[model samples]
Target: MLADGTIGEEELRYLADLYAAEVRTSDDAIGSFLDGLAERGLLDSSIVAFLSDHGEAIGEHGWIGHGIFHEEILAVPLLIRFPGGEWAGRYSEPVEHIDLAPTLLDRLGIPIPEGMQGASLLPLLRGEPAALAPDRMRVSQRAHGIGLSFADAPGLRIYFRRTPSGPDHLEVFDLGADPSEEHNLAADPASRETWMPRLERYLEWTRSRVAEDRAFRVKGSGIQEEDKGMLRALGYLGEEE
Candidate 1:
């Protein structure tokens, strides 16, 4: 932006190139590993899964990390090949990491342990309707104090933030209108009426999830006052105005 005058196409192309290289390298490593497995005849018996925890933002909105809840990060590539089956196709459904445990157990006819998250991969293998359904909306929270959420249900909050400061930079985009999130509506008070209530509901849901995670144990909260500020900067503040 310093020399380019604005976040123009050239800057975006540069960032895309960087991420593309990472993807290529990742593909190479996976290819090599699969080759090794095939050499030992273990590829057939082995259920291969390729997954990434999250994605990086090369320069989207002047950000560089993976805190935003953009589809780029919330969504991941999942390829699973089971043993002894004609299941070799793409699954487009929005699956969660939590669903993995249950799916695997279901495939093997083994019981899934309690308190585990994730769905099963059997539907995809069987070419079920659920597997064809699009991914359900989801949220992504990172240690960087950035939080993001999405919903098919409208009036929901879909945005990202930087770490907190006095004048915290909150970037909330109406994904319904701006799917790319190229615009920042955080400082626009005129849009608050629609977003505030939705944001409140989102906050409640977030707090509930946090409670379930046992994050507020009070024994070793691990976060300090400044941490809250950081979260605020990242747009993770929970307290009300």
Candidate 2:
């Protein structure tokens, strides 16, 4: 569907239908699993969470895929059903994937390690206000090559590119005013004085984390031809693979 630059109405409808079908299938499978568990008297003792790493951009912002610092890709669905569904309500505040482990540990009565960067969301889950620190920021990154990352601050989001050639590039957006990210505020003089320093600090911290992660990384060879063929068949890898 994303082969061509242009996306027709038929493509859009097909994408929507495909997404709907996947959702229905997933729900049915989960429901069946839960029914079995209930029959075994174990349904009321589990915490289920449904989330996605990123969202797809069919044609938003003239883009057909994710890995961009756009709301269409960043804002994903997160549904958490606790053991009893108590305190079940919508939370409008921003949360990140890093918080999941800490939240789960906190809920399980386990202590969160000091080395973890994420704060627990247990208070919010209990219907209380769980405010993030003033300086706390959410960061998202690309997974391949000289990776790109973005720091999401209050009302502002700064995207930093860690390219191998030339100088690094930055793109800033005022999400409060333009949630669609239609405007670029990086060039605005007023935004620089406020956001640049924060971006620099966050970037330094992120670089350190990346370095530490690399220190413990394990190298792997390229996948086997059979595995590559299977990935291609599943529409995960490109046809060229």
Reference-based lDDT, each prediction: 0.64, 0.71
For candidate 1, give the lDDT of residue 13.
83
Per-candidate TM equals 0.66, 0.73
Model 2: colliding residue pairs: none
- Could you tally the backbone clashes for each prediction? 15, 0
Model 1 lDDT tens row, 29-95: 9999988988999988887777888877766555566665765666687777777544777765567
- Cα lDDT tens digits, model 2, 1-241, are 2546478878877987887798799889878987897898776788787788888777776666665656777788887777877568998877877778888898899999989877788887777877544334545442322334454555777776664457776778877788777888889998798888877787778778987766543234367878867866654455544
**TM-score result, candidate 1:** 0.66
Worst 10 residues of 1 by lDDT: 129-138
RMSD of 1: 6.7
